[model samples]
Target: MKNYLFLFLCLLTQNLFSQENVDKKALKKEYFTTAEIDVKPEFPGGGEKMYSFIAKNYKIPESKEKIIGKIYIVFIVETDGSILDVKITKDIGHGTGEEAIRVIKMFPKWKPGEKNGEKVRVQYQIPISIN
Candidate 1:
Protein backbone atom coordinates (compact mmCIF):
# COMPACT_ATOMS: atom_id res chain seq x y z
CA MET A 1 0.00 0.00 0.00
CA LYS A 2 2.80 2.45 0.85
CA ASN A 3 4.66 1.69 -2.37
CA TYR A 4 1.50 2.22 -4.39
CA LEU A 5 0.87 5.57 -2.70
CA PHE A 6 4.46 6.68 -3.33
CA LEU A 7 4.22 5.76 -7.01
CA PHE A 8 0.95 7.60 -7.33
CA LEU A 9 2.38 10.69 -5.71
CA CYS A 10 5.38 10.63 -8.02
CA LEU A 11 3.18 10.48 -11.11
CA LEU A 12 0.89 13.21 -9.73
CA THR A 13 3.90 15.47 -9.08
CA GLN A 14 5.19 14.96 -12.61
CA ASN A 15 1.80 15.98 -13.98
CA LEU A 16 1.86 19.14 -11.89
CA PHE A 17 5.34 19.95 -13.22
CA SER A 18 4.04 19.58 -16.77
CA GLN A 19 1.66 22.41 -15.99
CA GLU A 20 4.35 24.71 -14.56
CA ASN A 21 5.60 27.87 -16.30
CA VAL A 22 6.29 26.98 -19.90
CA ASP A 23 8.33 28.99 -22.38
CA LYS A 24 6.88 27.80 -25.63
CA LYS A 25 8.96 30.25 -27.63
CA ALA A 26 12.32 28.94 -26.42
CA LEU A 27 11.15 25.38 -26.89
CA LYS A 28 10.06 26.11 -30.43
CA LYS A 29 13.37 27.67 -31.40
CA GLU A 30 15.27 24.70 -30.03
CA TYR A 31 13.31 22.15 -32.04
CA PHE A 32 12.53 24.27 -35.10
CA THR A 33 15.32 26.09 -36.86
CA THR A 34 15.82 27.59 -40.32
CA ALA A 35 19.55 28.16 -40.03
CA GLU A 36 21.70 26.97 -42.92
CA ILE A 37 24.92 25.04 -42.58
CA ASP A 38 28.00 26.85 -43.85
CA VAL A 39 30.98 24.57 -43.70
CA LYS A 40 31.50 21.58 -45.92
CA PRO A 41 33.35 19.02 -43.88
CA GLU A 42 36.79 18.08 -45.15
CA PHE A 43 35.70 14.46 -44.92
CA PRO A 44 38.60 12.24 -43.88
CA GLY A 45 40.41 15.11 -42.23
CA GLY A 46 37.47 16.28 -40.15
CA GLY A 47 36.37 12.76 -39.28
CA GLU A 48 39.87 11.68 -38.41
CA LYS A 49 40.34 14.68 -36.15
CA MET A 50 37.10 13.96 -34.36
CA TYR A 51 38.05 10.31 -33.93
CA SER A 52 41.46 11.11 -32.53
CA PHE A 53 39.95 13.57 -30.10
CA ILE A 54 37.41 11.02 -28.94
CA ALA A 55 39.97 8.28 -28.51
CA LYS A 56 42.15 10.64 -26.53
CA ASN A 57 39.32 11.63 -24.21
CA TYR A 58 36.59 8.98 -24.24
CA LYS A 59 36.88 5.64 -22.56
CA ILE A 60 34.00 3.21 -23.01
CA PRO A 61 32.88 2.11 -19.62
CA GLU A 62 32.81 -1.58 -18.80
CA SER A 63 29.05 -1.48 -19.23
CA LYS A 64 29.53 -1.22 -23.01
CA GLU A 65 30.24 -4.53 -24.70
CA LYS A 66 33.16 -4.94 -27.12
CA ILE A 67 30.89 -5.20 -30.16
CA ILE A 68 31.20 -2.28 -32.50
CA GLY A 69 28.32 0.20 -32.41
CA LYS A 70 27.72 3.73 -33.61
CA ILE A 71 26.38 6.93 -32.08
CA TYR A 72 25.39 10.06 -33.96
CA ILE A 73 25.71 13.38 -32.16
CA VAL A 74 24.12 16.61 -33.29
CA PHE A 75 25.19 20.09 -32.18
CA ILE A 76 25.37 23.72 -33.09
CA VAL A 77 28.66 25.39 -33.78
CA GLU A 78 27.79 28.85 -32.55
CA THR A 79 29.03 32.10 -34.05
CA ASP A 80 31.43 32.55 -31.18
CA GLY A 81 33.27 29.52 -32.52
CA SER A 82 31.95 27.41 -29.66
CA ILE A 83 30.00 24.20 -29.51
CA LEU A 84 26.53 24.49 -28.08
CA ASP A 85 23.22 22.68 -27.86
CA VAL A 86 24.96 19.35 -28.24
CA LYS A 87 23.01 16.10 -28.08
CA ILE A 88 22.96 12.60 -29.40
CA THR A 89 20.49 11.93 -32.20
CA LYS A 90 21.00 8.20 -31.85
CA ASP A 91 22.00 6.37 -28.73
CA ILE A 92 23.76 3.03 -28.34
CA GLY A 93 23.00 2.92 -24.63
CA HIS A 94 25.62 1.94 -22.04
CA GLY A 95 26.74 5.60 -21.67
CA THR A 96 27.83 6.03 -25.27
CA GLY A 97 25.38 8.84 -25.80
CA GLU A 98 26.57 10.66 -22.71
CA GLU A 99 30.22 10.18 -23.59
CA ALA A 100 29.68 11.44 -27.08
CA ILE A 101 28.18 14.61 -25.71
CA ARG A 102 31.14 15.03 -23.41
CA VAL A 103 33.69 14.80 -26.21
CA ILE A 104 31.83 17.31 -28.33
CA LYS A 105 31.59 19.73 -25.45
CA MET A 106 35.30 19.41 -24.79
CA PHE A 107 36.30 20.25 -28.35
CA PRO A 108 38.18 23.50 -28.87
CA LYS A 109 36.15 26.24 -30.46
CA TRP A 110 35.79 25.56 -34.17
CA LYS A 111 36.02 28.05 -36.95
CA PRO A 112 32.38 29.10 -36.75
CA GLY A 113 30.17 28.80 -39.76
CA GLU A 114 29.70 31.69 -42.13
CA LYS A 115 26.76 32.99 -44.11
CA ASN A 116 28.10 35.08 -46.99
CA GLY A 117 31.40 34.98 -45.12
CA GLU A 118 29.89 36.37 -41.94
CA LYS A 119 29.79 34.25 -38.82
CA VAL A 120 26.48 32.47 -38.31
CA ARG A 121 25.03 29.51 -36.50
CA VAL A 122 25.67 26.15 -38.11
CA GLN A 123 24.62 22.66 -37.24
CA TYR A 124 27.14 19.84 -37.10
CA GLN A 125 26.94 16.09 -36.79
CA ILE A 126 29.49 13.62 -35.53
CA PRO A 127 29.46 9.87 -35.42
CA ILE A 128 31.59 7.82 -33.10
CA SER A 129 32.09 4.06 -33.27
CA ILE A 130 32.46 2.07 -30.11
CA ASN A 131 34.28 -1.18 -29.71
Candidate 2:
Protein backbone atom coordinates (compact mmCIF):
# COMPACT_ATOMS: atom_id res chain seq x y z
CA MET A 1 0.00 0.00 0.00
CA LYS A 2 2.85 2.41 0.85
CA ASN A 3 4.61 1.67 -2.42
CA TYR A 4 1.45 2.40 -4.43
CA LEU A 5 0.89 5.65 -2.52
CA PHE A 6 4.47 6.79 -3.15
CA LEU A 7 4.18 6.08 -6.88
CA PHE A 8 0.88 8.00 -7.06
CA LEU A 9 2.38 11.01 -5.30
CA CYS A 10 5.38 11.01 -7.64
CA LEU A 11 3.13 10.90 -10.69
CA LEU A 12 0.99 13.75 -9.39
CA THR A 13 4.04 15.89 -8.69
CA GLN A 14 5.45 15.23 -12.19
CA ASN A 15 2.14 16.10 -13.82
CA LEU A 16 1.91 19.38 -11.88
CA PHE A 17 5.43 20.38 -12.87
CA SER A 18 4.77 19.54 -16.52
CA GLN A 19 1.60 21.63 -16.52
CA GLU A 20 3.48 24.60 -15.08
CA ASN A 21 6.06 24.37 -17.82
CA VAL A 22 3.32 24.32 -20.46
CA ASP A 23 1.69 27.36 -18.94
CA LYS A 24 4.98 29.23 -19.09
CA LYS A 25 5.16 28.73 -22.85
CA ALA A 26 1.52 29.67 -23.48
CA LEU A 27 0.84 32.88 -25.43
CA LYS A 28 -0.26 35.97 -23.55
CA LYS A 29 -3.80 37.35 -23.91
CA GLU A 30 -2.98 40.90 -25.03
CA TYR A 31 -4.11 41.83 -28.50
CA PHE A 32 -4.91 45.14 -30.13
CA THR A 33 -5.70 46.57 -33.50
CA THR A 34 -3.30 49.01 -35.13
CA ALA A 35 -5.77 51.82 -34.66
CA GLU A 36 -6.11 50.96 -30.98
CA ILE A 37 -2.39 51.10 -30.32
CA ASP A 38 -0.21 54.09 -29.56
CA VAL A 39 2.51 52.71 -31.77
CA LYS A 40 1.99 50.25 -34.55
CA PRO A 41 4.23 47.25 -35.06
CA GLU A 42 6.98 47.46 -37.67
CA PHE A 43 9.17 45.09 -39.52
CA PRO A 44 12.65 44.68 -38.13
CA GLY A 45 14.06 47.08 -40.72
CA GLY A 46 11.24 49.54 -41.42
CA GLY A 47 8.83 50.17 -44.30
CA GLU A 48 11.39 50.44 -47.05
CA LYS A 49 13.24 47.38 -45.90
CA MET A 50 10.02 45.47 -45.47
CA TYR A 51 8.95 46.36 -48.99
CA SER A 52 12.34 45.34 -50.29
CA PHE A 53 12.12 42.06 -48.45
CA ILE A 54 8.70 41.40 -49.84
CA ALA A 55 9.70 42.29 -53.38
CA LYS A 56 12.67 40.02 -53.13
CA ASN A 57 10.76 37.11 -51.66
CA TYR A 58 7.36 37.36 -53.33
CA LYS A 59 6.99 35.36 -56.48
CA ILE A 60 4.39 36.06 -59.09
CA PRO A 61 2.45 32.90 -59.61
CA GLU A 62 2.07 31.76 -63.17
CA SER A 63 -1.27 30.87 -64.62
CA LYS A 64 -2.44 30.61 -68.22
CA GLU A 65 -5.66 32.33 -67.17
CA LYS A 66 -3.73 35.46 -66.15
CA ILE A 67 -4.44 35.92 -62.49
CA ILE A 68 -4.28 39.62 -61.77
CA GLY A 69 -5.35 41.53 -58.72
CA LYS A 70 -4.28 41.93 -55.10
CA ILE A 71 -3.94 39.45 -52.33
CA TYR A 72 -4.77 40.85 -48.91
CA ILE A 73 -3.27 39.06 -45.93
CA VAL A 74 -3.83 39.60 -42.25
CA PHE A 75 -1.64 38.40 -39.43
CA ILE A 76 -1.02 39.03 -35.77
CA VAL A 77 2.27 40.39 -34.57
CA GLU A 78 2.83 39.09 -31.06
CA THR A 79 4.37 41.00 -28.20
CA ASP A 80 7.44 38.80 -28.45
CA GLY A 81 7.95 40.02 -32.07
CA SER A 82 6.73 36.76 -33.55
CA ILE A 83 3.98 36.51 -36.16
CA LEU A 84 0.94 34.28 -35.64
CA ASP A 85 -2.45 33.48 -37.13
CA VAL A 86 -1.66 34.39 -40.70
CA LYS A 87 -4.79 34.41 -42.88
CA ILE A 88 -5.94 35.57 -46.24
CA THR A 89 -8.57 38.26 -46.12
CA LYS A 90 -8.73 38.47 -49.91
CA ASP A 91 -7.34 36.23 -52.60
CA ILE A 92 -6.76 36.70 -56.32
CA GLY A 93 -6.76 33.00 -57.08
CA HIS A 94 -4.21 30.93 -59.03
CA GLY A 95 -2.27 30.07 -55.89
CA THR A 96 -1.43 33.72 -55.31
CA GLY A 97 -2.90 33.64 -51.85
CA GLU A 98 -0.98 30.55 -50.88
CA GLU A 99 2.19 32.02 -52.31
CA ALA A 100 1.65 35.20 -50.36
CA ILE A 101 1.12 33.18 -47.19
CA ARG A 102 4.32 31.25 -47.82
CA VAL A 103 6.30 34.43 -48.19
CA ILE A 104 4.73 35.90 -45.08
CA LYS A 105 5.68 32.80 -43.12
CA MET A 106 9.29 33.39 -44.14
CA PHE A 107 9.25 36.92 -42.74
CA PRO A 108 11.52 37.67 -39.80
CA LYS A 109 10.30 38.90 -36.43
CA TRP A 110 8.77 42.36 -36.17
CA LYS A 111 9.24 45.19 -33.63
CA PRO A 112 5.88 44.52 -31.94
CA GLY A 113 3.23 47.13 -31.20
CA GLU A 114 3.00 49.20 -28.05
CA LYS A 115 -0.09 50.35 -26.21
CA ASN A 116 -0.12 52.12 -22.88
CA GLY A 117 3.62 51.48 -22.58
CA GLU A 118 3.17 47.75 -22.86
CA LYS A 119 4.15 45.49 -25.69
CA VAL A 120 1.10 43.97 -27.32
CA ARG A 121 -0.04 41.90 -30.24
CA VAL A 122 -1.51 43.81 -33.17
CA GLN A 123 -3.33 42.85 -36.32
CA TYR A 124 -1.54 43.90 -39.51
CA GLN A 125 -2.68 43.78 -43.11
CA ILE A 126 -0.66 43.78 -46.29
CA PRO A 127 -1.66 43.72 -49.90
CA ILE A 128 0.31 41.75 -52.44
CA SER A 129 -0.23 42.45 -56.10
CA ILE A 130 -0.10 39.83 -58.83
CA ASN A 131 -0.18 41.60 -62.15
Candidate 3:
Protein backbone atom coordinates (compact mmCIF):
# COMPACT_ATOMS: atom_id res chain seq x y z
CA MET A 1 0.00 0.00 0.00
CA LYS A 2 2.79 2.46 0.92
CA ASN A 3 4.64 1.72 -2.34
CA TYR A 4 1.48 2.29 -4.41
CA LEU A 5 0.82 5.61 -2.70
CA PHE A 6 4.41 6.78 -3.36
CA LEU A 7 4.15 5.81 -7.04
CA PHE A 8 0.90 7.70 -7.45
CA LEU A 9 2.38 10.79 -5.83
CA CYS A 10 5.40 10.69 -8.14
CA LEU A 11 3.24 10.31 -11.23
CA LEU A 12 1.04 13.21 -10.20
CA THR A 13 4.04 15.44 -9.57
CA GLN A 14 5.49 14.62 -12.96
CA ASN A 15 2.21 15.25 -14.70
CA LEU A 16 1.80 18.63 -13.02
CA PHE A 17 5.30 19.72 -14.02
CA SER A 18 4.78 18.61 -17.60
CA GLN A 19 1.53 20.54 -17.83
CA GLU A 20 3.17 23.67 -16.46
CA ASN A 21 5.86 23.48 -19.12
CA VAL A 22 3.29 23.00 -21.85
CA ASP A 23 1.22 25.89 -20.61
CA LYS A 24 4.21 28.23 -20.62
CA LYS A 25 5.14 27.24 -24.14
CA ALA A 26 1.59 27.52 -25.45
CA LEU A 27 0.98 30.91 -23.89
CA LYS A 28 4.07 32.46 -25.45
CA LYS A 29 3.20 34.53 -28.52
CA GLU A 30 5.48 36.77 -30.49
CA TYR A 31 4.56 40.44 -30.59
CA PHE A 32 6.20 43.01 -32.84
CA THR A 33 6.40 46.76 -32.53
CA THR A 34 5.20 49.20 -35.22
CA ALA A 35 8.73 49.81 -36.44
CA GLU A 36 9.47 46.10 -36.72
CA ILE A 37 6.34 45.21 -38.64
CA ASP A 38 6.07 45.64 -42.40
CA VAL A 39 2.54 47.01 -42.09
CA LYS A 40 1.17 48.89 -39.13
CA PRO A 41 -2.34 48.46 -37.80
CA GLU A 42 -4.88 51.20 -38.45
CA PHE A 43 -8.43 52.06 -37.60
CA PRO A 44 -11.24 51.43 -40.03
CA GLY A 45 -10.87 54.85 -41.63
CA GLY A 46 -7.54 56.35 -40.57
CA GLY A 47 -5.90 58.60 -38.04
CA GLU A 48 -8.42 61.40 -38.44
CA LYS A 49 -11.32 58.99 -38.20
CA MET A 50 -9.83 57.33 -35.16
CA TYR A 51 -9.40 60.66 -33.48
CA SER A 52 -12.94 61.55 -34.41
CA PHE A 53 -14.17 58.38 -32.80
CA ILE A 54 -12.24 59.13 -29.66
CA ALA A 55 -13.45 62.71 -29.57
CA LYS A 56 -16.98 61.57 -29.98
CA ASN A 57 -16.80 58.84 -27.40
CA TYR A 58 -14.37 60.05 -24.77
CA LYS A 59 -15.80 61.92 -21.83
CA ILE A 60 -13.71 63.89 -19.41
CA PRO A 61 -14.11 63.07 -15.76
CA GLU A 62 -15.33 66.03 -13.70
CA SER A 63 -12.64 67.23 -11.34
CA LYS A 64 -11.91 70.15 -9.04
CA GLU A 65 -8.70 70.92 -10.91
CA LYS A 66 -8.63 70.97 -14.68
CA ILE A 67 -6.98 67.95 -16.25
CA ILE A 68 -4.51 68.59 -19.05
CA GLY A 69 -1.59 66.86 -20.67
CA LYS A 70 -1.16 63.65 -22.63
CA ILE A 71 -2.29 60.15 -21.71
CA TYR A 72 -0.62 57.28 -23.51
CA ILE A 73 -2.51 54.03 -24.09
CA VAL A 74 -0.85 50.79 -25.12
CA PHE A 75 -2.45 47.66 -26.49
CA ILE A 76 -1.80 44.65 -28.66
CA VAL A 77 -3.50 44.33 -32.04
CA GLU A 78 -3.93 40.61 -32.56
CA THR A 79 -3.79 38.81 -35.88
CA ASP A 80 -7.56 38.36 -35.88
CA GLY A 81 -7.99 42.17 -35.92
CA SER A 82 -8.98 42.21 -32.30
CA ILE A 83 -7.59 44.41 -29.58
CA LEU A 84 -6.22 42.87 -26.38
CA ASP A 85 -4.40 43.81 -23.19
CA VAL A 86 -5.33 47.47 -23.36
CA LYS A 87 -3.34 49.48 -20.83
CA ILE A 88 -2.63 53.08 -20.02
CA THR A 89 1.11 53.59 -20.16
CA LYS A 90 0.82 57.21 -19.09
CA ASP A 91 -1.79 59.08 -17.12
CA ILE A 92 -2.26 62.68 -15.98
CA GLY A 93 -4.56 61.95 -13.06
CA HIS A 94 -8.30 62.75 -12.64
CA GLY A 95 -9.42 59.33 -13.86
CA THR A 96 -8.46 60.28 -17.41
CA GLY A 97 -6.39 57.12 -17.84
CA GLU A 98 -9.31 54.87 -16.99
CA GLU A 99 -11.57 56.93 -19.22
CA ALA A 100 -9.17 56.56 -22.12
CA ILE A 101 -9.07 52.81 -21.59
CA ARG A 102 -12.85 52.73 -21.61
CA VAL A 103 -13.00 54.56 -24.92
CA ILE A 104 -10.36 52.37 -26.50
CA LYS A 105 -12.17 49.22 -25.46
CA MET A 106 -15.24 50.42 -27.34
CA PHE A 107 -13.36 50.69 -30.63
CA PRO A 108 -14.27 48.42 -33.49
CA LYS A 109 -11.98 45.79 -34.92
CA TRP A 110 -8.81 47.38 -36.29
CA LYS A 111 -6.88 46.28 -39.37
CA PRO A 112 -4.23 44.01 -37.97
CA GLY A 113 -0.59 44.75 -38.67
CA GLU A 114 1.52 42.38 -40.73
CA LYS A 115 5.02 41.17 -41.16
CA ASN A 116 6.44 39.17 -44.05
CA GLY A 117 3.02 39.44 -45.68
CA GLU A 118 1.41 37.52 -42.83
CA LYS A 119 -0.88 39.01 -40.20
CA VAL A 120 0.84 39.29 -36.84
CA ARG A 121 0.27 40.72 -33.42
CA VAL A 122 1.64 44.21 -32.91
CA GLN A 123 2.10 46.36 -29.87
CA TYR A 124 0.47 49.75 -30.41
CA GLN A 125 0.50 52.93 -28.42
CA ILE A 126 -1.41 56.19 -28.79
CA PRO A 127 -1.34 59.46 -26.91
CA ILE A 128 -4.44 61.49 -26.15
CA SER A 129 -4.07 65.11 -25.19
CA ILE A 130 -6.66 66.53 -22.83
CA ASN A 131 -7.26 70.19 -22.38
- Over 1-131, each residue of candidate 2 has an lDDT whose tens digit, in order, gives 99999999999999999999888867544477899999999998898888788889988887789777888999999888898999999998888888888889888999999998989889999887776
Strongest candidate by TM-score: 3
Model 1: per-residue Cα lDDT over 1-131, one tens digit each: 99999999999998877766354544533321324534532223466776788899997866635646999988877767677899889888877788788878898877665555666666777778886
State candidate 3's TM-score: 0.80
Candidate 1 lDDT score relative to the true structure: 0.71
Candidate 1 similarity to native, TM-score: 0.65
Error of 2 at 46 (Å): 1.3
Candidate 3 pairs with clashing backbones: none
lDDT per model vs. reference = 0.71, 0.88, 0.94
Query: Judged by lDDT, which candidate is best?
Result: 3
Q: In model 2, which range of ten residues has the least summed lDDT?
A: 24-33
